[model samples]
Target: MIVVDGHCDVLWRLWEDPERSFSDGTLQAGAERLAAGNVRAQVFALFVPPQVPRGQRLKAALAMVDRWHGEVVENAGFRPLLWRDDVPRVTGGDRPWALLALEGAEALEGELVHLRVLYHLGLRMVGLTWNEANEAADGCGEARGGGLTRFGRSLVEEINRLSLLLDVAHLSERGFWEAAEHYDGPLVASHANCRAVHDHPRNLTDDQLRAIAESGGVVGLTFVPAFLTGGEATRDDVRRHLEHAESVAGEDHVAFGSDFDGIDRVVAGLEHAACYAEWADYLLRYYPASSVEKWLAGNWLRVLAARLPARPMTNL
Candidate 1:
């Protein structure tokens, strides 16, 4: 089966340490590990940490995008999916595909044009906020629990106009609802779990999961141990989140986000990208092959095909 992981911080890691090789095994999403896991496509997130000054966030994001082009694009066995049509080419070939995603809108610096600039740079997915309030919206970490601002709603409209995937992974409850209400395009919680299974701010509530399902989007069940439970997390812990998410979101809306390098602590047996097949075997025991196939990659592919623009956008 072709596996498509929804989120990883490998680009941020590479930007942090320029000498780190993509083939390095210590990283959760090393190129070798991805190959071993049979991952057909992996979403690389451009995550600007909150500490970066607002003025410099855009530059930081561009630098990571440069690193992606400089390093990953040069790799022989990898291809970057710049448009929806690029998906089939990569999936049908022997090489692995890389999809660009913005983990937070801080990089946009409250300007809608910056979103267009990033889109030109090959960004296909965007998340409005990371863990705190930005100019666009309040995040899960915000104490006030506010929703999308006027600018945030406008950004959602622009994202729809551009035909990019809108990710609601770290939005506050109100912000999520705001986007859900306005944006009729493809939506995804790139790296979130079920709050019903584990009560964490990052985990989506059952209602949130159902909203994603009803929209024909997928909830990528992540591997964050803390989001899985208060105690140490194991493969079974991952199973619990998946089971609960499937119950609420239905099998078609559930998939693997992994959160690989983005997460600090790892699940016991499913530590890195290379171990995905092992987890797949475990999931197979409980779910039928067809359901497991959807969880592995089909669901994400379906969303991408539906949401991505048919023709690439030109200079405006």
Candidate 2:
């Protein structure tokens, strides 16, 4: 299967410590597992925390992407994938493809011009907010639940103009609807779950799920325990979310978004990427193979190929 995860924090973690590659023993999963597990492409996000200095957020993000690129170039088994165009090449043989993404709009520093710079730097996928509000949009945790700001509107428009995919994973409810109602193309909740199942503000409400589906977007079911079951989330916990997401967003709009290396806690049986195959086995009982393919990776890829521009080599 050509698996494409919409989210992962390996890039930020690697930048924190380049000594530990995916092939290294420290992290849960790495480049080696991606190749071995038949993951065609994995989106490695440049997660910028709100606490980080505003001026330094973009720098930090770039540094993380650079670290991943260095690892891929130095390692024969790994391949760096900046655009959809490189997918064929990266997955042609046994190598695994790496796609760079931004976990928050903080990297843009509240300026649409900064977005252009980041896009030029090779960011194809962008999450409008993290757990806090910024110049771009409001996060789920924001007290006001504000929608896209003036600057955010410009950013979203520019993203659409440039054919860059917009993700509303951690956005506030207002911002989520704003993006859904305003954006003309496909949208994504790159790493989120159903609010009906978890009641957490971080999860998507039923209205948001339908909006995503109506907009022709997908919602990546997260692997965090709280989102899956709020207790000891096992393989069954993830299964419940998967089933619910399929029921709400339809089978084509559900996919795996293992916030690996970002969330401190993972579901009991889904601690790493290698366990995805096992997760697949568990899912097989409830869903058909075709439905499973879309959930595993196909849905996200289809959206990207349909809406976003191929990654330009100059940026990365």
Q: Local error of candidate 2 at 5, Å?
A: 1.1
Cα RMSD (angstroms) for every candidate in the order listed: 1.8, 2.4
Considering only N, C-alpha and C atoms within 3 Å, which residue pairs clash in candidate 1? none
For model 2, residues 175-289, the per-residue Cα lDDT tens digits are 8888876788888887889888889999998888888888888998888887877877888777777778888888888887888888788788778777777777777887788
Score every model by TM-score.
Answer: 0.96, 0.92
What TM-score should be assigned to candidate 2? Answer: 0.92
Query: Candidate 2: where are CA atoms >4 Å away?
Result: 73-92, 310-316
Local accuracy of candidate 1 as per-residue lDDT tens digits, 152-227? 9999999989999999999999999999998987679999988888889999998999899999999998988988
Tell me how far the alpha carbon of residue 206 in candidate 2 is from the true structure, in angstroms, after superposition: 1.1
Mark the regions of model 1 whose C-alpha exceeds 4 Å error after superposition: 313-316
